[model samples]
Target: MHGKFKGKHAIVTGGARSIGFEIARQFCAAGAMVSIFDYNQEALEIATTTLTNEGYRVNPFLVDVSDQLQVNLAVDRAEEIAPVDVLVNNAGICLVTPFLNIEAEEWQKTLDTNLSGAFYVAQRVCRYMARRGKGVVLNMSSKNGLDGEFGHAHYNSSKAGLILLTKTIALELAHLGIRANAVCPGYIRTAMNTEVDSDEFVEEFEDRYIPGGRVGKVTDIAPIFLFLASDDAEYINGQTFVLDGGQLAGQKPWKWLLEEIKL
Candidate 1:
């Protein structure tokens, strides 16, 4: 427990699996007491067991971040274990439906979870951090926040709001020694992404969209979160880091470029 983050405590929402899980693991590895807030009870149990077996301090709480009451209660429970020094608002959901086909409920659900949930957690945690005069908040934004995509209007809007929310938090919390930033990832190969896309589609996507020629893995993103949470990132605030493998650097004129090139 004598590492870079020794004596620190972190809460990672959606920390049961995928990117969130990796973030929690990295924090625990760095000697931080980590609490995982996830809606999936089974996944939470599994994650807790796995981390505990690995000799890491991990506490799992069943929390639906979209509900302020639940978030508040969860925070109370986590504080009993350790005062939160870092908060990663990584819980989010995406819907793939044509704009015309998107229902009001679906749109609300996306915003409720992605934007409002982040707000609730950050606001609650910053209150405590403000008292202590130090903390870090890392939000999981997306490449869609910078650029729109087809069939993802709701998802895009939520992430876009989150980026602004991160900036707002940074502005308001800086005086209290709190830093807020967003990480925008594109096409990360997570369970959620793989559920939506086939392997063939992913291969094609890497070839056409990702200049780096590979979809990003959870490992590729976890270290960045750790860096943002550490003291080394004291000056980095209100910034959005796009970990998209150059996918957003330029437009992909797939049809035109393919027609021009034999390969």
Candidate 2:
């Protein structure tokens, strides 16, 4: 509600739904001109309409993040309206398959969307930021990147690479006054995770994984991104903000105690 990002321009990749949509909404609410860039035309239109109707500055563009040409053109179009002040590399894909069963194309697809896509958008946006000598880039990584997830080797690898990419870019671009960082979210309630809607997964996710006793909502994450995008985090760079309710702290179990006893 505070005009933290007032008079700024931001682009949110994968802004159609879930985490990306929430980031876009927060940017708009905080007095930023938000651009929704996604591949889903229907969701793009719907999101644009809703946000614009709410008296927020919103513009939707249908583009595949993995395509460099599309990304460059979209940034160009967005710049025509206003120079982009923040870039959220939120577009990503997930494929759950056993490591042995994973196909080359499937791995490539996930990598292209999750890791390479961030590179493409970042490279493009950095051009604009370089000219202005100021901007922020926020990459979306996941807890799976830190701790491997079964049936998600490709996704894990892609996100892991993305985090390193974030760090490298941060170090390299600091001289240009561009800040880069990542957000790793664990067990967020999103459309992609239909299991969150099921009673089965909800019970499992809460009882075993998240110590917070509940899954994260989109609203839970938007503020963090907004903070990173704003000048408030000017000193925070090349770091990852983990919002997993201490999931990475490791799970408590009895078997480990027996091993410790033997030791």
Candidate 3:
């Protein structure tokens, strides 16, 4: 559990906060030198400072993943610090809008950030992995990628595209010893979710939808990223691991019938 990544280098996109931040922290705790890339300068500084203060190796870079030039530059800076052995493409954006009301600009922005950004970051980092003949790429997908959600046309489309993108990367890079995988999380207690949903709604939704009786947390996800990036998961490739507390397992009609009988 400890030092599984000792002496390795990891680059985590969107690592300034939430799930991304937790992943970066876990990697550092496992003894990997970590570089956090984020668009938010203030958050990046704070996270980097906090991790460093905790006696962890951490470097922060301000880069927008949607911009290829910025991603390239950030990779260069990260490589200067250490050769990247693990790349976590965790940066993305979601815009919830009805399909009929979604504007062209909004759709473009969502895809550009969620899909194209992951592509740019992965391609740039995988090139180095290819040269080294070994690396791991973990993409942050969403449960919405597998099932449609209301008022999330753009978000769902981008995540669906990312799943395919992950597969393509895995197939192409497996020959080079670079494994690619995706983690599809549902109802995580992140700022993105809390910002939109009220406390009452969160409590009700968890009770109704999550079979595990609660929504997931950042800790629930970070370890999986570490496992996939570590040597233990060398054979795991081109797979999307859904961590949703069985939310996608479908409703139980038999259970409904039992309830009806009781009524």
Candidate 4:
């Protein structure tokens, strides 16, 4: 818990804000010389300043994960600082739209960033970890990947692909001591939903669909990522964990059914 990762390094993609930022901070708190990779230049500056001010070491890389060349270069640079002992494939974009309203370009962009981007980083990092014969790779999947949503075919498909990608990585790299896994969080409160008018909806969603009657926080999710990255979970790999406040275990609220009239 304390300074176990002092000499090690961790990389967090899309780490400029929200869940990714929280995860990055926790890793730093654990004493890892962490690197934050994000496409937003301003966010990178702010995040870097925040962490460094806390007396934790962090290297920020302006990276668009959808680009393989950038992914390779960023990883290379991160490696120059220290070998990556843990990788959190958290960079992704979610643009909501009905399936019929989805364009080819939108679908491609989502996949490129969410699924393909994870591939690029995971493969590059795993290659390094493979040589060392050990490492942890954690992909940030979503509950949308598990079940269907009203609007988000492209986003759903990308996340769904990540679960399989994680499995494949685990199976292929098991002999190499590189563990891969995914976390599916449901209805977590974050700034990613600005496009949607969901203040009232979220309250209802929590009270109804989510059995726990509350939404999740980054604090609720960040600790798990650190756990998976640690030796305690050395025996756990190639699996997906759902942190949804019991939402996945329950059924939809009456409002959802009323909207569709399944019968």
Candidate 1 structure, TM-score to reference: 0.95
Better of 1 and 2 by TM-score: 1
* Model 1 lDDT per residue over 1-263, tens place: 23899888999999999999999998999899999999999999999999999999998899999999999999988888888999999999988999999999999999999999999999998988999999999999999999989999999999999999999999998999999999999989988887889999999999889878899999989999989888888899999999999999886666666589866
Residue 27 local lDDT, model 4: 91
Error (Å) of candidate 2 at residue 206 is 1.5
lDDT (0 to 1) per candidate = 0.93, 0.90, 0.91, 0.92
**lDDT: which is higher, 1 or 4?**
1
Q: What local lDDT score does residue 126 receive in model 4, on the 0 to 100 scale?
A: 94
lDDT of 4 by residue, 1-263 (tens): 77867888999999999999999999999999999999999999999999999999999999999999999999999988889999999988889889999999999999999999999999999999999999999999999889868779999999999999999999999999999999999887887874574789888777778878899998999998999999999999899999999988967557666678655
Error of 1 at 22 (Å): 0.4
Query: Model 2, stretches more than 4 Å misplaced?
Result: 195-197, 253-263
TM-score of 2: 0.94
> What's the lDDT for candidate 1?
0.93
Q: How does candidate 4 fare on TM-score? A: 0.94
Ranking according to lDDT, highest score first: 1, 4, 3, 2
Off by over 4 Å in 3: 252-263
Per-candidate TM equals: 0.95, 0.94, 0.95, 0.94
Angstrom error at residue 178, model 1: 0.7
